[model samples]
Target: MGKDQDLLHAVKTEDLLTAQRLLQRPRPGKTKLLGTAKRVNVNFQDTDGLSPLHHAALSGNKELISLLLEAQATVDIKDQNGDSSTAL
Candidate 1:
């Protein structure tokens, strides 16, 4: 699978380490890591239109939720069923 697909899978399964690695870009050895330049889109939705935030929220994973939020996942994006992450 591609990086985007792997990222989505990591998020869906609540695999924090994999998700973090996918979201973080490796910097120059001495360069300080900055915010989200190479991070995956946290709001990417599946075929059903369910985003990572929606899955995280439904699974009650506060850590994953926070991570996705920090990555700028849109909480207001609705799924195929018209349910937003906040409403999940």
Candidate 2:
């Protein structure tokens, strides 16, 4: 429940394109409107203490894992149980 929560949702729902698009920041006519979605923080954790990278790893999405890594998602971030995405 935060500004960039959609980023987490996109990862959770397996919506790769939407996740990719949301990662893009809107520029001067070079991208689509993402509203607040454009300001998403790649490393932001949800209430469950799970970050997008965590979900991607849990879902076994290699493509999403690459995207998240490219976006600088912190791999060592722990979840509610102090588990990290080092599974990647």
Estimate every model's Cα lDDT from 0 to 1: 0.81, 0.85
lDDT (10s digit) by residue, model 1, range 12-88: 88899998887765666756558535556777888999888888888898988888888788999999999898898
Residue-wise C-alpha lDDT for candidate 2, range 21-43, written one tens digit per residue: 87875677575545543477999
Evaluated at residue 70, the lDDT of candidate 2 is 91
lDDT of 1: 0.81
Minimal lDDT window, size 10, model 2: 29-38
Off by over 4 Å in 2: 1-3, 28-38
Give the clash count for model 2: 0
Off by over 4 Å in 1: 26-39
The RMSD (Cα, Å) of candidate 2 is 3.2
Overlapping backbone residue pairs in candidate 1 total 0
